[model samples]
Target: MSTWNRTGPVVVEVDGSAEYLRIVDYASAEALRCGAELVLVAPYSAHASVSPMMPGYSPKAPAERADDALRAAVAHVRHRDGYATELAAVAGEGSRVRVLAHAARKARMLVVGRSRSRGPQRLMHAHTNLTLASRAGCPVVVVPASWKPCLMDRKVAVGIDGTALSAEALEFAFGTAAGREGDLTVVHAGLPAEHAWNDEDPDHSWISRADHLLSETLAPWTGRFPNVRVTRFLSSRQPAAALVHESSEVGLVVVGSHTGALPVDPVARRSVAAMTCPVAIVPHHVTATDHERISAAPRRPARRAGRSDVLTP
Candidate 1:
């Protein structure tokens, strides 16, 4: 069970890599905008069976080293941003996916950096991003290492499948667009007609049905976010390809991952890896009971502007 409460901090994984630093910058800016604390987590795992007969086989040394690295990385980022009070650091011992996934249970969102490799190389080592996106308690945002902050056309793109998962993604996309005062583009990809039909052809009923479905899916959200400029893109291509192409022009792409559909759908996996900008994977259903518990918990006071704190796990 995972809570989808907004009271939790935004968690970002930091490994002191160049890609991780870029992630830090993006995550920091996002945290400030959302008025949420930024948590940097560094996860490490030690090799098993270090024989005492060998020189200096201390079991606690690996954990201490990981903690030191995490502390340094956090301090560096905090100093660079001059946002000491808005940040916290945590050091955990385990595999990266396991540790970060655990942290995400109490986070508003989890942010991570993607590798520069593309095509086959990228696919070969995309398990980390896929796992986090599919299994995290909250939404997971994956940003490319080469992405930098700059002036650009601001728009949020969401893929709509007319499913409950897609509805949740629509809510997130609409809220994000409203918060940023950006444009919202809802894309629905439908299969092509088996035979060409003219405008007046009576056999074009399927096309009309697809159009109606798109409209019905977006009707409520358009009213909810009246201020957000909305654009509808109905494409004949596959959903993954259409969204991947749309990702090039938007600041963020929002996609839905069913609760148990991971490593099973090749299209979903490919879309996440192909996106040029940050990709946000929103789950269909988070635990309602967990949300209640989190909402009922006591709230902590805001930290003073100059204070800095580090948490260990």
Candidate 2:
């Protein structure tokens, strides 16, 4: 089998930026646990081509650039190898999206960096990471530019709502904790209610159910993974804000995805947006159409501090 196998290959888009180096450490650790390998598909795409915009442009420079990056990135990763990896660079046909899309095929997941949002420009052009996440055949993981988190060995944190889509997160958290030989913590954030049909104060009901679900709905999971820890938080604020706050002390944070759902709902959108830690998004289910819209969109670079996209930066 390829070094990057059917399991999590951790296809990371490497620009060879100092900021992205942490991915090697994170990937190596995870691969060791899952018996998977780490792979590097460094797509070489340059926006500064001086040639004409037409179809017959020369491919030499871009091809060579990719080759160089692949050699360098592979060397760096090998120096830290904890798992087998396929280190190769691809000259993205027209855009970076092409190569990343290809890499996403049969790979466990995609991890990319987030451009600090600048303003309207960012909104329109978008970031390559979001593009991949929105379009990849599998779930895309966005690691912040300066993100570095510990491995999942003990204590787990996952966000859950009352929906079936949210339930997928439990699998990742459980599997991760088990791989670590440690405990698991499952957290659900929402306003509470009484019976399935009963209506009560959302805040009061949410807190009540948060405790109840841990004891009831997740009872079987507790037994499945000994030393499991769970807490339910009532959230009335931004979903991401609540998750971020609760997960600050955790090694890894998992959030379920409803990316291809009818609306792509607000929760899933916030789950991936602006998160400063390594994140695993379990997309409930997705289709090719979703990937197309995600990859075809153009992306602008991270804007300067004064840009409109940043409110407080």
Q: Highest lDDT, which number?
A: 1
Q: After superposition, how far is residue 28 of candidate 1 from its true place, in Å?
A: 0.7
Ten residues in sequence with the least summed lDDT for candidate 1: 304-313
- Models 1 onward score TM values of 0.79, 0.70
Per-residue lDDT of candidate 1, residues 1-313 (tens digit): 1123445888988875655687887888778778889888888777645786877855556667667767776776667777643778888888888889898887878988887887887764454565675576577888888878864436899887664446667887887888788999888774564532456774555556656777887888888789999988877766778888998899898877645442323556677778889988776663465356536857655431111000000
Candidate 2, superposed: residue stretches over 4 Å from native: 1-8, 46-60, 82-94, 118-131, 149-155, 192-204, 214-216, 259-261, 286-313
C-alpha lDDT (0 to 100) for residue 44 of candidate 2: 66
Give me the candidate number with maximum TM-score: 1
Q: Which ten residues in a row have the lowest lDDT in candidate 2?
A: 304-313
In terms of TM-score, how similar is model 2 to the real structure?
0.70
Q: Which parts of model 1 have CA positions greater than 4 angstroms off?
A: 1-7, 48-62, 193-206, 261-263, 286-313
